[model samples]
Target: MKHLLRKTTAWIAGAVMAGGLMLPALAEADTIKIALAETPSDELAAFFVALERAKANGLDYEWTAFSDEELAIQAVLSGQMDIGFGTPYAAMQRSRAPIRIIFQLSKLKFFPVTTTKYEELEDLDGEPILLHSRGGGTDSIANVIEERLGIEFGERSYVPGSSNRVAALLGGQADATIIDLSNTNKLMRSPEADRFNVLEMFEVEASDEALFANLDWIQNNEEDVQIFVDALLSTYRDMHEDPTIIRRETNPDGPIGQLPEQILGELDGFYGDAVDAGLYSKDGGGRVAANADLEWYSAAGQLEGDPSDLNIEDFWYLAPLDNAMN
Candidate 1:
């Protein structure tokens, strides 16, 4: 009886020790760190909606916003963040970062706004144009324009913010500039509205933002990734089916609610414009958008070699998104 009791006590102690060692691993597996390329704005309203869903599903995530996409990319590359927002095509291709895009956040819906001096795209040839940043969406648009129209404009990236770019155009610091949907609407409604003209922008079937993560991290946390993607996919479909869902799901104590009153006031209009413009992809998996991204980026000189030669599988891992969609 003593010998049996001693064996039982030893087994219980070993089991407890093993369980203690597993606790931290379980906790770490549940947490995800995300990085955003830009500050919280109306453009990210749907993401905020999905975040609420993720929380409800027991997925823990924390995010930080960086001033630029480069910084966000670096954060992910350094393992400081598990996921990153932004399309960093060139940097990813050049550095061969082990990042794979899992979700397409938004389509390219930027507009080219200019002072009254430039009435058309051609009119701005050889003139200095304000863009968001080098290798950003606006810069890609400029690249496509230069290729299609056979014209070149002096590119200036002094201001990375869309609102600041609009201000530059209004203040005569720039003759022409490209700004996002919100800034475009604000400029159109401003007192100086008559002074600016929105040129007809060429449409590109490219994504403005994508959710990417390190390939190893994704493989290790496949289940968590799927859960996050599933929540996001459902949120996209819900938003498309009912645009007002954005206002409904917005948490009063959440990030969107915490935004300045003036910015929050524009939320309805911002999402309304997005739905009207077909900004969000109806297909949550982003397969079609992924193909389009290759072509658009390659054409814009953001990617090297022929787009046809590039395999979508190389840059995009659709398993998580695919599982989410189904």
Candidate 2:
């Protein structure tokens, strides 16, 4: 099950190693291989939905899952993976990975969970904190804390996964950590609820995850790329138009329905919980890129110009998504 969520090895060797998302005439003919992160999160589900739809539209494809976003970007840069699920906007701004965010994947809407000893972000200024990794989503949240509340965390540690980070907090090893919807929901319902406090802090703006590809590869496989992007646009429309479509599409026997038993058991309840928490959406149209432009500009210290004066198209090439949707 963990193997399924982190499918990077097989696909990287077979697809990305060969060349981009396209197959040469001498290469084995199966499907275009795409890179994905291993977990069965909403982003993965959306990609799976697009895969199914793309298949129906005659666009056959395979998938490879990486352990984390950092590796996913490396895969695309090295030409070991075609299009991975998501990459942080900061990565593009900071790294030499010749990649572009082709489509917006998802945003990190976090809930701050702290040990009961503290009540707010201000309360966490002088404390030890935990996160997924040095440059992961949770770490990005910590940066927001320094930027907004004018507080610096006393000590910092990386735990590599949000679930593990959450465990660190639960065992009284750390004061606080920013976690995703799934873990956040689980923690709130746990009997140890009395041990922590979830704070409603200022939202962090980021293009949390995005579909990225080797720009050179995408330049050559225009036709296949259009088909792939089209399917995603369709799924995007459905996902935001009605979040419940997720539950309906995720059959116990289907790709999403076939999640690890533990994660599967929580699907329906999680989906409902996510919708109520403003986690999932059905109106995800052009908002992701727009948000990404503003968010990245600010995070990169480039938001000085009026957001209205900024030309977002300079940062995004929506032709793939546009061609796909049309």
Candidate 3:
């Protein structure tokens, strides 16, 4: 009897030790890895807010920023990252990456600004235009313009940074450039504001950024993904109802907080412009935005085939987002 009791106690102790080891694994499973197409900026303020909320909800996450969208997409494809930022339509169509967009983050709110001499898009005919890069958002915009307006502008790509593009425009390196919302606002407020004019460009009914992940990983981590989407959807709703929520949730120690004071000060204005421009979707988990993305990307030549034939359900996994929304 004494021998049997000793053996039972030993077995119980071993089982407890095994369970202790498994605890860390379970905790680690809750963490998600995210990849950013670019460094954090004022435009991603609400996303940062969602990150904070996710932390509170026990969904820990880490993010890495690549220099460009291509690198970010590659990281996700190789499984080096769990979630990537941009929707690589061409890459997806060609390589058949098992990636599905889970969330539509923002819309294409880009603007074309040029020297005062050019008053409209028509005036840019045959003129050199500074673009973000080949096969990038700015390039897509240029392609759409050429197709719609039946005019071709010489393309010059020196750097991918919007500030660099803005500098090129201000320094007269290029007569016209397409820049982001923040830079557009900065130029409008600059002392040289009168020297430039923001030409009206056609509105792009497409997503500027999205949350995409490997299909297998998404399937395995559906619960965690739902938590993340829930947090993000709530944050978006909060922002739409009260734009000031962005300022209220600004974490001084977070990524956006580390920005230069000049940029930081412009956060309100940047968000204000975004809000006025309807850059964000009110239906956080609806398919309307996804359908629009297909049409816009197809028109821009980013994706092959007709937009009407492409089913958005193939590219998007709406379950997680829909579950979060409800």
Candidate 4:
């Protein structure tokens, strides 16, 4: 099967080299459009650092910060963007538009937080839950929880961020929600920590955020994609070598560098924690991560199929990351 997957990649590469794929409206020479799911902050410093590196290598790009992950996916689907930050597994399966995840930005390092009323995941049986968005990472977490714990949840509400969900929990507006690692740490350290419980969850190394685009578009703009992937791979490796490098390489005149002093102060710590948690795989999540995603999103109810039966090449065009490594 692994050998067949390689052959599939070879076929795709051959086709791309032959210019067999149709060119997208965003032509090969046009600036790449990147859809950011949220406003820039500490969470995106490393990505911005990579962008700076890509820029140094002559990759032209512009980024739009969408309201949420779903909108980001929609932007790419609508051809309003060239690439986006998200896991569009559901859209990929349902649309069949040859959308392929190129690189994984972060892993599913989220924690399920609840009030003292729930002691475990199973205890939340049929209980209302607050989440990040309709089809985003938190929603998939909820789906996986229901499947794994054999407990169906009641109402599922959408708030945008983990910090906002934390607010809802504090204001008595919500009792449970899933949040990222940094926010989870903050919540546990809060004075209201006694009021909540961070449920013990099974380890999930699936992608939480990734870069994806229509395969035709990627093939059309192979050079830019290669530069971008190379820059990202270097940044992830450098972060593992020393997380402080993100803070150091942050472009002082760019988006991440223009943040408030407090956020800037925490950038080093944020990347440090993220690297320590293995939030990014050094290979940038090609074949292994694609297979893991199939297993994960399948169990999470986002994709329909026995995981092993899924054609990984359909959901992931690993040629870019593969070439970047070589």
lDDT value for model 3: 0.78
Candidate 1, 131-196: lDDT as tens digits: 876677878888899899999987566567888887787777887888888789888999999998
CA lDDT, candidate 2, residue 69:
63
In model 3, which runs have C-alpha deviations exceeding 4 angstroms? 1-30
lDDT of 3 by residue, 1-326 (tens): 00000111111111123433421111224347788877787877789889888777767677887877878888887666778888677777776456789998887778989998999998988888887666767777888888899998875564667888888887878778988887888889989899899999887868878888877678877777888899889888888887778877878988888878987787777777777778888666359888887888888899889999998877888998888767
Native RMSD of candidate 1 (Å): 9.4
Judge candidate 1 against the unseen true structure and give its global Cα lDDT, from 0 to 1: 0.79
By descending TM-score, how would the candidates be arranged?
4, 1, 3, 2
Q: Give model 4's TM-score versus the native structure.
A: 0.90
Deviation (Å) of 136 in candidate 1: 1.3
Winning candidate number (lDDT): 4
| Candidate 3 similarity to native, TM-score | 0.87
Highest TM-score, which number?
A: 4
Off by over 4 Å in 2: 1-30, 41-43, 94-98, 251-255, 260-262, 280-288, 291-297, 300-311, 324-326
Cα lDDT tens digits for candidate 4, 217-246 = 899889989999999999999899998998
- Candidate 2, 1-326: lDDT as tens digits: 32222223242223322434453222222356677655556436656766667767776566666676677666666565667755445555555545566776666677779888888889888788877655656667787677778888878887755677788888878888888877887898999888889987775445556676656667766776777777777776776566566656664555677667777556557666655665533333244656555665465343445556655554456678665555
lDDT of each: 0.79, 0.64, 0.78, 0.86
User: Which ten residues in a row are the worst by lDDT in model 4?
Assistant: 1-10
Sequence-dependent TM-score of model 2: 0.78
